[model samples]
Target: MTSPGVAPGLLRVQGLCSGYGRSQVLFGVDLHIGEGEILGVLGRNGMGKTTLVRSIMGLLRPTGGTVELGGRAIVGLAPHRVARQGIAVVPEGRQVFANLSVLEHLTAFARGGHGTAHAWTIDRLLHLFPRLAERRSNLGGQLSGGEQQMLAIARALATNPRLLILDEATEGLAPLVREEVWHALSTLRQAGMSMLVIDKYVRRLIGLADRHVILEKGEVAWTGSSAQLEADRSLWSRHLGL
Candidate 1:
């Protein structure tokens, strides 16, 4: 399902280790995402899920290890530089600019030079998120939680990233809204958008992602297909305490 102009295995991470102050979070984390593949990173809370995403996005520098995007080393680059390298993140809590309008947020990061031609654009993002279009003039702080989540994703996509990394892809949202978020992800997968999705919804993730990586504490505890995950439910109960 690779797009005509898109390449596969666009992002790769090896031996990633990071933490806050003296508390180590991730240790020797290794993972990769192929073009058009939806890879799910599953684990319980405080299992270094957010830390892993932060390390890859350059929000936190890894104590040791390497991060590569499209075969280039990006381990210690700045966050802005990482973004320029075609990586975008929809962080947990949907942290949008509180005073900025919907249009302002989208246009702020619409730098299109690095992305592929015919990449995600303002019109396309608006089309994908109709609710955002309806509230283009509303301040980001005024939108509902679900709307903020949608805007967060739309804002990232507007950057035309090669890999979209979502941390806690769906958390604390109403059931119906969570379904909408998942449905949006399905649509993106069909459109050949590669993603590194972090979520607690293991049941639904098995159906959405092509591959799964379970993190125990901070290391890769298991890696396999969705079928393998289901066939071994004990695996989740053991490592994830689900």
Candidate 2:
């Protein structure tokens, strides 16, 4: 299942179906994230965008289909096993360890066992998130909302994953912080980090992501390049009601 492109994809998902309790959220969702490309998952709230991420991360078990990371079957595996396999996710709501200090959070989740490169070391993470460095000794709860979001991304990156999935990467942040986050994402893309970005910024997603997949009513209603999505504004207005 090789995706043809400049720098082919590292993550591939097909026929993904998942749910909470008995209520299914994702129904036959399909998507891919190229080796160095940024893929955006677009949809209105409660449209199953976050559920797709949870399924891929193994935080939620898929009722059907496969989630392959670097071309290996990972469906139904434990969350830690999935993370160990080089698939890391910054879940929605920036779930940082409230009891840990900023630096502690980094150290606790440091890269190990995988023998991956140190591209996301504490120093580099600090550089990427200067505010976190400023509050390195502060408890995670002591940081602002935007700062906590930064820490969440930094914590995920510190694992040095092959495919990074960010659920609502820039949600609820101030405009300036959102800009900073977009800047960091752009830099990561340039550095050849494959990412699955979920956000509501249509205009910016068009610029940053190489491809786009829109989830509607728990299904993949649209899939194409960013240009295709931008060209068809009606698609968004019709499916996402944006």
Maximum-lDDT candidate? 1
TM-score for each candidate, following the candidate numbering: 0.93, 0.93
lDDT of each residue in 45-72, candidate 1, tens digit only: 8889999988888889899999999899
> Which lDDT tens digits does candidate 2 get at residues 45-145?
99998888888888899999898887889997899999999988988899998999999999988785244444778898899888888999999899899
Alpha-carbon RMSD to native, per candidate: 2.8, 1.9
Residue 202 miss distance in model 2 (angstroms): 1.1
Worst 10 residues of 2 by lDDT: 1-10
Clashing pairs in 2: 9-34
Q: What TM-score does prediction 2 earn?
A: 0.93
lDDT of 2: 0.86
